[model samples]
Target: MQKYLILLAGCPCTGKTYLVNQLQQQFKDSFVITPDEAKILYAESIGFNCKAEKEALEHKVWQFYYGVLQLYMDAGKRVIISEYPFSDKQKRQLSEFAEQYHYQVITIRLVADFDVIWQRRYQRDRSPERHLCHIMQHYHYGDTLENRNLADDLITKDQFYQVCQMRQYDQFVLGNLIQVDVTDFTKVDYSRLLNELKQIVKL
Candidate 1:
């Protein structure tokens, strides 16, 4: 089996998670690394509360995430990193690693209009499925984390819009780029997407 490093990059609420699930189903043996899940598990192992010690959590998550990525690559497994907005520095690092390991790199970037992205984020904020750590970090405002509810996500909404407007969440273009328009999830052609990906990765 040829090894691959599949990088899913996009802004928040851009349907990366949904694509991750689709890819997982399509490629059963491929290893998927989700940073959010990694953060949660690492926090638990270290007795770190995201609500209380939020400052260093992201740094820790990236460190652990990169280590795990290298390990899987060394083992010659297909690795998928879901929904990361990689910085330029990170992209260069990944490029070097991919070249060293002879792994084919595929980058899938999901994009949508700001309005659509906001609507998706709004619904996600109200949904019970969203993890508490995410809510506390993104949605927390003047309210205490313990007493906060999902009735409002004002602060994060404004911040996210501004960030997206400036394209902060967009990552640098990398190997075999496939840009997907996901303004409307119902209209996204998953079959065509899978076929396109299969052609490039030769899956």
Candidate 2:
């Protein structure tokens, strides 16, 4: 099987994880590296006046993520990074990682209508202790309001969102990238994506 550094980048609730799972089932010798799913590990390490302890927990998650990344890379496993790539710095990090390992980068940028994603974001379960809780509620912890908008306009806007920004990819990466319009994923012809992937990474 061919080795691939597949980066599933997208906005919140854009189905990055769902796409990652789809790819894992489609291919062999594949492993997904997602630290977000490790929240269960953080659940036990947070709360009270233990801000320092919470920070430590977050650090450990990164350590665990990178450690697992090393193991999979060493084992020649096809790796998928299912994380939000919404910044130049974040996308560059994925590009650099692919370059450092001589692995061809296949960035599958998931996209959707701003309003669709915004609606989904608010409907999802967002506990106060979770990451980005402050940004989600637009209020600090233990704060409340009669009405709050859970959608973040800046992050949801494609023009400002780095991953969805086509010009940024032109500046940050040369090629071997494709966009998956997930606005209607269920009705999408996924075989088209597979054909496009063949053009770049030989997956």
Highest-scoring model, TM-score: 1
Q: What TM-scores do the predictions have?
A: 0.83, 0.66
Q: Provide the overall lDDT of each model, using Cα atoms, as 2-decimal numbers.
A: 0.73, 0.57
Candidate 2, residue 96: Cα displacement in angstroms equals 3.4
Residue 104, candidate 1: alpha-carbon lDDT: 83
Q: Residue 140 lDDT in model 1? A: 28
- List the lowest-lDDT window of 10 residues for candidate 1: 138-147
lDDT digits (tens) for residues 116-173 of candidate 1: 8888887776566765456554322223344346333334678877876575566456
lDDT per residue, candidate 2, 1-203, as tens digits?
A: 55677777666677776667667666655667777755334433442224454455557766666666656666676544455444465565556555666566677777777677766665553444434422332323343333334533223344434444554432333236677777776876677876676566565
Question: What count of clashes does model 1 give?
Answer: 0
Error (Å) of candidate 2 at residue 201 is 3.6
> What C-alpha lDDT does candidate 1 achieve relative to the native structure?
0.73
